[model samples]
Target: MENERNEDPTDWDQIGFIISSKYRTAVLEQLVDGPSIPSSIASRTSLPITHVSRALRSLRERSLVELLVSKEKRKGRIYGVTEEGKRLWERIEAEGMVD
Candidate 1:
């Protein structure tokens, strides 16, 4: 998660990327089941709202996850894993990396 944008986008390991942050991993895992509001994800993952927001922003940046609500909405904005996120998550889960 440290200056990873500089790496070749194709060369970057998506699985490794999510695995590097518990926040990111937890958010992804929660979304894997289905899209949910940030509050639900934070509550289920036992992570702070701040952390979840950061993770969401990062994942969205890579097109791994997406906002399911209007961008103008300040609250109740749901988030869901993208197909790309599902693929990376499946690879991570297959390796028993999910908590």
Candidate 2:
């Protein structure tokens, strides 16, 4: 979906800042079910591995979610949603229902 439109810079920025792209939203949804590896996220979301990785990087930069841990020799890195991420998920779901 396209980003919500708003003339007020702050209002637009508030939502747009969280989900700047569809891939980012997909990444968030994957985490909502539970923590999983990036590969798992890609499989579940049907997003390209490269896109998922990029989205995860952006999410991490914003502190919306975090890599909980890496297991078994730096493989199977589990990611979890932070408090802010949850709130954003709620907003996205709510808006989706309206749409």
Candidate 3:
């Protein structure tokens, strides 16, 4: 879906910062196709759950990622990239920001 928010040039800096971490980049890569839980992401990326959790938090704070379920639930809090996130992901891919 198209992002409702206008693209901000400064968002490049935030995107750059987020993808700078290998774990966060891996997390984003996994989410590109669809939403997933932290455990799934960690397993797929072969990263620790704690690390993935941290990455998700950072992504959420940037509005690049969002939780699909209640925080209190905890067991299956699905995370997906926002429309703005998709736009940023495309830019990052076009620029070859990460492999």
Evaluated with lDDT, which candidate comes out highest? 1
Superior by lDDT: candidate 2 or candidate 3? 3
TM-score of each: 0.85, 0.76, 0.87
Q: Order candidates by TM-score, high to low.
A: 3, 1, 2
Query: On residues 30-99, what C-alpha lDDT tens digit does candidate 1 reach at each position?
Result: 9999999999998998999999999999999989999999999998999999998998888777768876
Q: Is candidate 2 or candidate 3 better by TM-score?
A: 3
Candidate 3: misplaced stretches above 4 Å?
1-7
Taking all chains together, the TM-score of candidate 1 against the true structure is 0.85
Q: Which residue runs does candidate 2 get wrong by more than 4 Å?
A: 1-14, 70-73, 97-99
lDDT, candidate 2, 24-95, per-residue tens: 888888887888789999988788999998988888888777989753547777889888787768876876
Full-model lDDT for every candidate: 0.89, 0.77, 0.87
How far residue 17's Cα lies from its native spot in candidate 2, in Å, is 2.9
lDDT of 3 by residue, 23-80 (tens): 8888888888899999999998899999999999998998889999887886889999
Deviation in angstroms for 10 in model 2? 7.0
Could you tell me the lDDT of residue 97 within candidate 1? 84
